[model samples]
Target: MGTGTGRMASVLRGACMVGTMVLLAACTRHGHEGYARYRTNCGICHHGGEGMKGEIPPVSGRVDKIASTPEGKQYLMHVLLNGLNGPLQIDGVRYNFSMPPFRAHLSDEEIASILTYLATRGDTRPAPVFRAADVAAERAHPMTTTMVAEERRRLDAIHPLP
Candidate 1:
């Protein structure tokens, strides 16, 4: 609170400006296509960000660690672009299902945005690492869903994800 009326008005204006900025930033992050596309492509299977009875894996609250490493990032890129199939395990649970690829359906940027969104969803001051160029670089080595699964297998063998 300000002591004088002039000071009070200035403080109120400053506070309102800050509030507006935060609101806009939040809306931009949450309402952006990254989230909407994620909902469309992933939310159904990963209902509420959790796995579906050990079939479809959860996409939220599980990516920060995965996005932290070089190999993990590579695995994530291939998984999204190529679609992961065959047997998979997470948190000591066995999951044998196919994750449909979006290489044909989505652009490199779209995929990048989605992965960036996943990696940074829990971040308060989100700084995205995934980029269209990164996706494009991986795009050069287009692997089948099974191959993507193998990539993940190799990644896990070297660096286990949590």
Candidate 2:
């Protein structure tokens, strides 16, 4: 740990921090915050939409179908605001994991943006875009994570994803 080595390390760290800030700022300025937020918050676990060997579900097809309907839209928004747990099955695959709620971590617009991002990730016919108000309405009447799971079940029964 010579002085030169320490100084070089510090300089590298500072450069990395500054670069990250600039990248984040660009996303905000360019209206790519949804993609940025998803990468920062959800990408690790979901592997950027590819599930981790079935422990997680890809945020594609099924969610797109869900977001397309009114009840399904509300349910998805609730899941976003309150979070969801698993022992859940989707499209014949079983996934067991806990999804922490983002009610506090994200603003209404941010949540809508994430949802909109997910909804358009694939070639989902009639991709539905989310409004911040859609998220705000769900945020107002907060549902429990457990309640969200129940709603998922009801939604599954009524609108079972293909």
Candidate 3:
């Protein structure tokens, strides 16, 4: 009986150590508060920024470019706050899904963080960090998803994808 109990204790310790390592790795991979917020709020569709190619546009590499310009920055803020309904063509691929509005659920700070995370990942160019103030300003003048889409169209005309 003593031998069996000792073996069981050893196995339990080993299992505990493995669990701890897994938890630590997960935390390391998703250490930023913005990354956590993004996983909870946007990852379902965006898939941790990889996106669903041909359906949802990838936010990682591409968002940095879009967030570089003034009007483009405003467009991002509007899209996050108002959500977008589309028939939108990104890089010649048309995505016809609707992105649900997060204005009611997320605060300006959280939205800013998520956008910052999206804009910074896997990018070489120096992009401006999105601030809570920027989001708050956009929130002051609420636009519908349709309006956001129109703004996207205008921006697209000026900066067509390569």
Off by over 4 Å in 1: 1-31, 122-128
lDDT for position 15 in model 3:
100
Per-prediction backbone clash count: 0, 0, 0
lDDT by residue (1-162, candidate 2, tens digit) is 999999999999999999999997864653487788888888888877877756988785566888778998899899889999987887778898899999999999899888887887767766788899878878999888889999989888997853
Steric clash pairs (candidate 3): none
Better of 1 and 3 by lDDT: 3
lDDT values of the candidates? 0.79, 0.83, 0.83
Off by over 4 Å in 2: 1-31
lDDT, candidate 1, 1-162, per-residue tens: 547988989989999999999998975875486778788887778766777857877777667678777778888889888898867788888888888988888888888777777776545245446778989999999899878877778878888875
Stretches of model 3 off by over 4 angstroms after superposition:
1-31
